[model samples]
Target chain A: MTSKALENGRRSKRHIFHKAKVNRSHAGNAVVFTCILILGAFMALPFVYALGSAFKPLNELFLYPPRLLPQNPTLDNFIGLWTLMKSSWVPMSRYIFNTLLITAAGSAGQIILASMCAFPLAKHPFPGNKFIFRVIFLSLMFHASATAIPTYIIMAKLHMLDTYWALILPACASSFGLYLMKQFIEQINNAVLEAAEIDGANIWQTYIRIVMPMVKPAWLTLMVFSVQSLWNIGSSTYIYSEELKTFSYAVSQVVAGGVARTGTGMAISVIMMVVPITVYLITQSSVMQTMASSGVKE
Target chain B: MNTNIKLHSLQKRRLRDGITGFLFTLPFVVGFILFIFSPVVMYLAMSFSKLSLNDAGAMVFENVKWDNYINVLFEQPDFLKRLASSLGDFALRCPAILFFSLFIAIILNQRFHGRALVRAVFFLPVLVYSGAALMFSNDALSNDYFKLLSSDSDETVNLAQYVISVLGGTEDSPILDIVSTLMDKIYDITCSSGVQILIYLAGLQSISPQLYEASSVEGCTGWESFWKITLPMISPMILVNAVYTVIDVLGNPTNTIINTLYSLAMDSGNYGLSAAMGLIYFLIIFIILGAVFFVINRFVFYEENI
Candidate 1:
């Protein structure tokens, strides 16, 4: 028993020495980890504070050294939020439906449209193919702000202002989605296409059948990117129609005017902001994992 | 005769493929011309014309001169000051955002507990706060409202007066004063490019673990291995983030040029100056981005090189 105890003591000493050596070697990484955590908390302050304030007693909100966490919290803010700008501000349900419709439609349209655009760029060898791809690439980096005025004017001319078509038609041919799809398709093996050809499949058959299966990861990535535009405030802000308001527009409206009441305003914004993201988290949990993983190339 | 037949078949195949490609890109081409190309040309034309609300509140287009541009650029005080302030804000915010985000990306790439959850939280702000969350939170955090509570006077509650108590610290305060100066840059970084850190982290992980193993076998420590191994591997992603951040901020509607455009269309009826400002904004971004691409191409080491 005494011999065993001594042996255990020696083993533990060696383990401690090894761990200390490892920690000393990676002291820099630990420092970096701490900095990252702090910055993350700093960046997350508004959201965390919103979450905290959303649940806090209205009387406690203005307390200095603001409570990072709520004390004696309730859902009264949410109760108040649901009824905000109650008159003539479009029903909350309508706003949510509008947003959902736009997000679903826009994402579906982009995937289909971008895939069609990507097919030739990825597989077909045509003259000026490189030039066409370059044009798409250049436009992919173009910000909405740069050409928003033009887009607005065009939408007006089409009599699409304040209508569903305003959101749908202008953004259908997304250069970002096309460029991303082409990049994804290029990673698929030529062997897959060759196999499909051997099986007497046409070009479309190969693309839809063999090639697309390999690019499931790409599809999820595009879905996430499309949601950004679909839910974006910038485009909605410029599109300029009250009846055509999206989820983002609704959220902005809750805060924009006569919202001098801070906690309730924050509560409304948080719900509007979180509703879609929460839905995404639940439905696309697996896709989120794949999305992050695909961000890296092997 | 056999050579002629084969050449004819080849020509026909090329023609078929071209037609297919054109059909695929037809929507983008049509959308681009109708929405992007033609509208830009029209706006430039509109700037030279007289566009205003009539007594009946209908928009009337009358051909005017270069007066609009001259008035906004040379004569307007709010326009110039807002432009200068926005330029200052952009210059101040962009670098701090780039460094802090890339730095966090490196930290996240390390093997750690709760790494995925950490990434999700970091990315959450970017996805949500860029919209309504900011405007609402801005009201709460905007001003000093604490003073209003202590005073029992029957006046209206000055909410900003209450909140300003937290941030009313002097320029001489030790820790928080530094935070104050850096806070705007940090908030912008958090709001705009927090998701980018996740992208950069993925780029870092895609780096082969073998590189570190090989470096260590040759007696390289973590720091030296980083300089030799990490930066080169993630350079392409760095370019992606830089261009995205720059273009995103430059095109923000709250920006002076965009606000000017909105006001001109809605309030002022000075279409010509708005067009010039919009074009000038686009030109500046284009030139800066071109310069970035040139430098990045020269310095960045690609995996293909490896």
Candidate 2:
């Protein structure tokens, strides 16, 4: 049957399926392309606009009927932002260091811990596994802000308030990464694990050496997610000290300079946005691969 | 004697596996207990108490029987009103996001030029709009700028209104109202559906080409095959995206209910009242998710061997 379709020269070498309206007609293709182009423009608008606004001179920033791209671009905002950073009480590098520390620790801990927990839950059917999974699933429904007060109280009780742990520990405990890793782990072939077991590998050995390597895409995706969230950790309910504040918190402080510093504020926003987008760009393929198996099964 | 020895070894292995599994999950268990479980309990307690700060800025809870809940539910109608409106918005946004993402995903899955670039563009929001980035992007100045641009586009909106009227639909017609609401929220819908589109694209790629080949051989058109093959195969992702969309929309910082709760806690310093409101809001979300899961579970097609 496929041979007949192939003989008709309808199948494109690039695509998997034979073309029998499966690949759209030219008009349909044009429509789809147009739709994609339009939507893509809308999706990219905010970043582009922020970039343009950051480059706009102070006089052009508040122009009525705002242009999508700045008419007169300048590096005054970047210069101003640099000058402002130099004048800060806490060194600008300190804020960057704090953000890097938190992002690195939080992301590493989240991925390692989530992958560790997910392996057992996915492969081993131990007692309380289902209940624990359900609890974790239910926890995902609770927004972080909703639980902020209690988390603050708990942190205070632990004497971890105003410390980096306040940010990193809670981030490490997030359930979404675990859930995602588990879903991906479940897609692994059981026979491979069994083969590892037959080689006298214990559960930990199998998890570390075999399962972990097999689920690299999952961990990569998880890393992107964890880094995205951690990189954006601004003012936390728990952390109060100046030195402990993240880069985002610092940028927000610059933004809080009000109307006069609008250009500088936008420059900071653009810088803040670039890091995660770069991470996503690097791991785009792995993230997409992991997402292929991200569906929830009954 | 040999069989008995084999059984004994099997039992020993089972015990070892159980211990290993438990050990593996210990970090999460401890973290969950300390961070999630205890805080949830404390928050529940706080909801039923009057929360005040002492001289040292320590939270002191004075037990108050049902007062906070009563105050949230009855004395102030704002919470409930916001909750209802948020839910209404969720109902509209969730389906629109799902449909838009799926539509985009289908286009993205097709063989095309600049597909990688398009995919990256679609997934950009997953990074760009998350957490603090969103907070920065939605700052007062940017919002004002966006508002100015939107107001400048009022002529286009008026043209839309004229076209609708010419089509014999009043501005206030239910269908036209929905269309206009969706039109206004197109940017928001586009931003939020990035992850959903990724999920859908993933699901689309995972579907076997042989199914399409067989379907075409059996005289199925692309449209027919899509409904017969694509929709059912993608139903699981649909369910996942639906639940995610609901949670995302509801838990969004810009959500009115969330904002109301934040203000009640932060500005008004009504911690007990805010906790009560949060609990109520959580319950509503929980129920809605349960209903979504229940309804969608019935139609979700899970292939056993896929």
Candidate 3:
């Protein structure tokens, strides 16, 4: 009876400690929440300020101390931007069309090509596979900016300058995309591929039917990355034709028009960012999953 | 012998696999050689040759030599200083960005309400910081902030100055120096941190919760659990994020070195010098990355959990 009482006392002590732990966690929750909220606000600060300024009138664009929100919000800036574009020689719609065409085609091509190359590098045991993979990783070490002059020369030689090919072809064989996809594909179960092989599916058929579906999350993540990168076609310096000018290039031109065009510049900025943000929101969870699995092994 | 027959089939299978792999990678290989490799070779040659644009706007290489390299390395006055400052800037900002990202990732990994929304908010910057969006948003914030600070119309004292006065530190005190330098580039700090934060979050989430639970049962504090379990488990990712961040930061088009190269080639009509400068800068970056990989590889831990 004495031993039983002692056990009961210990159980009660443990229950009390658990209760305290729950209470302590509750207190911690409040602190953590506040910290996250502050960080979120900070992250959103510039975008918020720009969004506000986009709606503000021209006179209010550069107000000292910079009001967080416009006192008298208006859609005039967007209207003004529309008129400004309407007056341009190229017709702003054409710029948008060019951008969408180049970006869509380029990004799709990049994803497909990168995935194709990545499959062999990730799963196939071929001669020079390791050497090729190492070469691709090493390519990532250098800045693409440093290659601009030579790339310009290459495009010129291929007669691709002043054409959309200049923009699309160079971006299609992305080393980083290949590396990312390869790392992700390496994590898939070998058993699944072996099973497919036993089912009499050829290499191409397996890659198309089985491997693609299995790595849907990864490719979607790649799509998000590709779309963002392709959408941001700042001056291709190679593509100088007025007809080939991209929407981003047009916005940059207007934004460079100085203090008078600040409101319209902000409006253009908002328009440009909206698509990528939506894409990111939809794909981020999948991105997080793939990235966690894709962490490089030492 | 029976062994010879089995070896013959094995070699045939190997040949098939190798051929299939090559077929799969064909398009990428073709494009890679044409677009990347050829240009890289051309770039190296251009660095050692005088280049001029003909009336037809085609590039012509003449007088093949290392004069461009010599001129850039010794003749140019501002090249070395700019290189030093940019590298110094790169070195200082990387640790700050990594530390901040890791801190935010730790907090974000904890269970909380509206966690998805918070994560999205943090990630929004990454999505938005591209092309025209980046141009306007960053310019808007930093431009306005600078105007406000320099206006001197308000009664509010400078925050950094006030802190300095209170602390009574000399001009070169490490703390004061870092703070003052950091104050100027606050916009860059906030903008460049989004990707690193996502990376760290990925690393943190990959750690098994069971490890933490077991540590707690062993009478370990949260701090102790983090140091002993979380750090080692995520060391591989730390190295990945570090390499990624370094490359991303250096590759930014707005970088001073890149800007100088653009002006040299486009404005000053010095393509050869620009090419040489770019090559040298790239070499320096490669060396830096190699050193970083060497250092970090020693600490990276690969788990056999899978």
Candidate 4:
């Protein structure tokens, strides 16, 4: 009877109301917090395992079931990676240099070319502009693989196979890039470009001196994107030449050494993967938001 | 005469600007013609002709009269089954990954320590897992991942054989069927490559924070805010991811179209047939992409509202 009376008193009080309110909110937050932690871990797992594997020795790797962390960790893997990278039959540095050049050239080339073409498509009233833009736009709908074989044959007939042009030239004028860039620059006020033109800025001068600076952030964001893409490119199983390989291709070559082979040449891969990753970390920190947004808006 | 000359010069200047604009775009025009347009036209030509790689090391071209297309589509062994399976798998996987990624992305979009790091980590799979990289590192990732489902097989593959053995030991038990079904589900989820997650994370971060603030002031719960604000805002992105995912799946290593192309070109030495198959694949993708664009176009909510 006394417990019932106390419960009745509690149920009738303001203190009870405040206490229950806090309790309900706490429960809600706790559920969200738990979900966030699990999701974060799920997102972070690949990097963890990749880092762990880079540091781990072979014995730990080939264990019946994998363990999450290395037991007897050492820097031997890094040291081995350094030397093994240099010892590769092919010139590793040339491949690295070529990849960097291609990536830079491609991204800059695409952005400039796209920006210029997009200006007219978005701002000007040129005859056949919409038709031409539509042609480029519709080509994007065509699956890349569908064109891969035909493009390969085309490159062959032009005597451009197994060359840098083969790798870089095909994607120079990207349909997706043009569409994206046109949409972006279109959002800018024509008044802005018109004002610049009124101040003795010719079309070329207006684009270079004014429009380019305004879109600087988008440029960096796209560059980072293209770098990340160029870093991971390795579709050259058909373009077979040992000398004409990129880092990703080399890494693939190592990992896919043979059916039974243990893929001992991963020292090069361990080191090479770090280069792009490091570059990405440095550049992406500032514009990660921008890169994310460009993709988002698209 | 002086006024006439000035007017003529102004007209000449306007003409010059148009010519310069065309010239500025000339490199791209040239590239488009040489790389994209010409190849497409050439492929059409090559499709109708049997471009045999001759003994003398040149394309021995002969007109095949619709035979290549007919054979690849209707009569090529494993063609229809493989194509259907690829398409079905793509359909089943796309939505599941889309939802899963959005779920994870929303969770990441919440304020937290290491927010930048978390976003970068989410983006890593997209950066690191190129088609070649995946083909190589799949062994590494899968070997580790496979253990989450079952113990070491003493053999690597042949999942059905293991199922039969488990059944044999249990003698047609209900538990065996349950285990197999659950295993199948796990495999299905794991097989979804993680690109969808990156795409969704990009979409989530694009949502303006002000919307959340406004929604909160209205006494909206997190769930309500998500449904009301976030979903509609990122619908365009979802469409882009869907389209990209569908098209990207065709080029994936396990894809049958890619494998068939590889085999026909290299093994059969019939580049003509492969070209025809490619055309068919491209045609199919074009149709599907058009439908997707039309579907998404009706629902796009532009940023002007926010």
Candidate 5:
């Protein structure tokens, strides 16, 4: 009877501790809630600022005190862009077409080529495998900015400077995508691949069927990254023809067109930003997975 | 003799796998060499040579030893100063980026109302901060923003100055100077922290709840549990985020070296000096990465229990 009483007394003490913990957490929750609310507002401010400026008329854009919201909203900026394009040497639709084609081709090419390289590098124990991967990691350390002049020189020699291949091909050679894909592929169980091999599936069959399907999340993550980057490529120093220029390049030109083009510039930015934001909204969870697995663990 | 026969078959299988690997990596390797590696080697060679256009407008290079490197180091007015300023900004920004992202990630990890919407809002920067959109916004909006702030007679600008002064400072005051710098850079800081927050959130979620529960059972408070459990477990991610932040911060559009190099090569027609500047800047980056990799490798914790 005494032992049972002691157990009851301990249970009551634990319950009291739980009550204190819950009270403290309620206070902690308030503090956390305020911090997140302020931060979320700060984070959302730029999008709001951009959106507001996009809808503003030219006069409102220069208003004193610089209102975050437009005093007078209008679609004239977008209409102006369309009209401006109508007067230009190259048709606006062509610029749009060029951009869409390049983004689609570059991203799709990068994903496929990176995956192909990543699969074998991740799964196979072959001669020079470690050495090849090390070279890639080392290349990541070297900044590509400094190489622009020589790259231009080499492109001139190859006679590929003005071609669409100049833009697409160099981008496809990126090691970042390959690195990300390789990391994801390494996490796949070897037994799964072994089972396919035992069933008489060749290496190609295993990669296309088993590996590709298993790493779908990584595929989407890479897709988000590639599409976003390809969309942002502004001016290529190599591509001089107006017809061959990207939509982003055109948008930058519109921005540089002076004070009259201010509203148009804002509209173009909003249009450019909205697509990637939409994609991220859909694939947020998977992108987090990609980033988590990105770290090189010991 | 039997063991030798077994080893022979194993060797054959290894050679088969090796060929398969080579074939798979062939496309990327070829592209890498043609596009990435060749330019890098050409840049190195061009740095030591005088490059000029011929009568036919074709390029010709004549070897010119250490002249380019010496000129960049001693003669150029803007090269080293720009590099130092960029490095200083990098130092100031890295800690703030790490601290806020960690703080935001922890809060986001908590069960809160409309968490998904909040996450989408925060992640907006990662989407918008690249390409033409970012350039446009940075150029167009910042022009308007600066105009608003600098108009001395305006009420909002006046009120802002009043409040800033109340927080305490004249033009040369250090406390107010840091505050103003932070205020100016607030947008950039928020934008860059988005991906870092997501990475930290993933790290936070990967921590098993049972550990938290056990710590609570042992009478640890929330703050105490965070220090003892959350910090140690996510130490690896801290290293990753630090490296990622370093790359991203240095890779912004207005990077001084890139701007200076472009002007030197194209406008001023000084190819060799530009190439030399590029090589020195690259070496600085290499040294920085090596140091970070060494320091972080010592601290990053791996989960052994799994």
Candidate 6:
């Protein structure tokens, strides 16, 4: 037993030594860093260009060799966009409010419902568990457009045609969120859950307390995806009311206003992108923290 | 008598567990039936029928049997051709996107200075490539700029061609064709991979540090640990990402099949033909997903329940 203990100590020391060597490898680190930097810049180019173009004056927008950075930056585009929005039939703030309402409700509902559904499917053995999962998986294979008309008809029948529920309800039912949450939940060790059960915590309580907190990163990632898609929802066939249109729909209108509104269009793009990017930034730190502690030990 | 009583309670507990499980999944089951399954069934029916509006403007379905399918499959000049090419593109790009995103995810998961900023930059594509920003970037002025940029790269293309010839490969060789196609599509691959990278990063982080520690204690190298431990641990995510990539690529707005279907439905007002085409597209997607899921599922290593 003393010899076994000694061997274990030596092994751990060697492990620590190896880890230090890996971390202190400067040449490999430099190569990885440089590659990431170059790729990051390449990926960020279009967004940076868009930002610059939003600030460019009219003539600068039309420059033949389009400048990556606007030579003469101005706020004219933003001001123009404001004026254009002010002249619209529906108020700009209404569009923003509509988008916020839809995105918030849709994402929250999806995360909650998907997680609630995913827990049982992931952990519990029921009569139709596998069948339900298979169905959900199959649903994710097709594009949403294939179901658009029939969904519209269903919405009409339910008398939900013009309201925000038209958008929120369908998003709440999205198969992708359930699938993602299920996968993440499956990574959790069953022992943690069994311990909870032995403590007399019921299924629902355990799910709320144990499963939900454990899979925080999954739901957060789902939020990013849900918000991104819901925020970008443009004119829908089911919603014909001008008051019910989305901010993206309004932005598309400004974009459609022809060549003269190019500056304002770019400005609107910046505005539209800011919300989702901000959402990602705020949640990213939490996502990383949760993921760090998410590992299950045998 | 005591054992019989214990068995009765055991059966009751199982019954409770089953009911509770069913109740938990109730919301999704209801939502799926109402929203997804019903619509899919309706679309299938529409695919096999002639959809026309009545005087009251309600849709009328006249049974057309196989006509719509026949028209889409054999008669439409560009439909089959576009489908074939799009499938080919999907075959090439799905694996590329998966590999590239995994590579980027591994890099991002490493501890480094300015990691958060680099991550934010990497996720920029998910923001800018969707909605209004995409439309803005595809505007005429930007298109002109891109055209000019390509023209300016003529010298670089010539140099590449000369190098290829020197390497004993013709410009139009199949290998060169694939390489050039991939080269041209690098921006697209990068743009479409943001969410994928996020998924992978999450997957990477969920892998227990204990496994790595144990492997290191066994004198395993970093490379070996990656293949043996990390790969198996992340295989489930690989399945998820693979399915997502396939669907995303096929359903992309710019895909030829999608564009053709859109035009057939909206521009030409041929709903029946469009529905038929959509069903066919969905079948292809289902087949591809099934193949991917089957192959990846076999390799996916789920930790056994304790």
- The candidate that wins on TM-score is 6
- Looking at candidate 5 chain B, the ten consecutive residues that score lowest on lDDT are B143-152
Q: Write the per-residue lDDT of candidate 5 for residues A45-162, one digit (tens) a residue.
A: 6567678887888778766445667878899888987788788778878888888888889888888888889899888767888898878755665566667777877788889988
Return the interface RMSD of model 1: 6.1
What is candidate 4's lDDT per residue for B1-306, written digit by digit as tens?
Answer: 999999998888777767766666667777777778877877777778887667888667899879889988777878778878888877777667667667666666666678667656655555545422353453434423333112222434323234356345543568667766665554344335344554455455445566677787765665677788888777766765666666666556457777787678768878788878877877777877778778876776654434
Candidate with the larger DockQ of 4 and 5: 5
Q: What is the TM-score of chain B alone in each candidate?
A: 0.70, 0.78, 0.75, 0.72, 0.74, 0.84
**Comparing 2 and 3 by lDDT, which wins?**
2
- The local distance difference test score of each candidate is 0.62, 0.76, 0.73, 0.62, 0.73, 0.81
> Tens digits of per-residue lDDT for model 3 on B1-306?
899999998788779988999888889887887788777778788788888779998668897698999999999889999999989989998888888777777887776667667877887666665544555433333323322222222333333444465566454467776776565466466567777676566556556456777787865656678899888866765776677777877767667887798789778878788888988988887888788879986886554324
| Candidates arranged by DockQ, highest first | 6, 5, 3, 2, 1, 4
Better of 1 and 5 by DockQ: 5
- Candidate 6 stretches with Cα past 4 Å from truth are A1-25, A291-298, B1-4, B137-183
Off by over 4 Å in 4: A1-33, A141-146, A186-221, A235-243, A251-269, A288-298, B1-25, B135-236, B302-306
Worst 10 residues of 2 chain B by lDDT: B148-157
- Top model number, DockQ: 6
DockQ of 4: 0.23
What TM-scores result for chain A when each predicted structure is judged separately against the true chain A? 0.77, 0.86, 0.86, 0.76, 0.83, 0.91
Pairing residues by index, what is the TM-score of model 2?
Answer: 0.84
Q: Write the per-residue lDDT of candidate 1 for residues A1-298, one digit (tens) a residue.
A: 9999998997788678667767886786677778778767655555666677778777777665465578898888777766675654667677778788888887888787787778778777677778877766655434555455567767777878777877776666777567556655654446556666568776667668765555554555567666765776433644566566776666655555642456666676566557546634543344334323222223
- Runs off by more than 4 Å, candidate 1: A1-25, A82-91, A122-125, A130-149, A176-222, A232-244, A247-261, A279-298, B1-18, B54-96, B134-175, B201-233, B298-306
Q: Encode model 1's per-residue lDDT on B1-306: one tens digit a residue.
A: 999999998788668767886677667667666755566667667667666678998667777677666666678777767767877877766666677778877776566787666766777765654545444433322221221111112333332222234557433446555554455445555656664564565456445466677787765656677788888766666765666566666666546666666666657645667666565556667776677667775766654344
Report the lDDT of model 3 for residue A8.
94
What are the per-residue Cα lDDT tens digits for candidate 2 across A1-298?
8889886665454244445354556678888788789778766665676789889887777764345578878899999999999999999999999999999999999988888888889889899999998888777777888778888878888999998888889888878778766765665657678788889999989898887766665576567778888898888778788988988888878876667877886787778878877777776555444334322222
Q: Which stretches of candidate 2 lie over 4 Å from their true place?
A: A1-19, A22-26, A213-217, A287-298, B55-57, B131-182, B201-236, B301-306
lDDT of 5 at B132: 38
Best by lDDT: 6
- The digit string of per-residue lDDT tens for model 2 on B1-306 reads 999999999899999999899889889878987888788888789899998889998778899979998898899876777778888888888888999999998988877777778887887766666643555444422322233222222332332353466566666667776765565578677878887786676566556566787797776767788899999877867876887787888887778888888888889999889889888888888888889989997887665455
What's the distance in Å from true for residue A260, model 5? 1.7
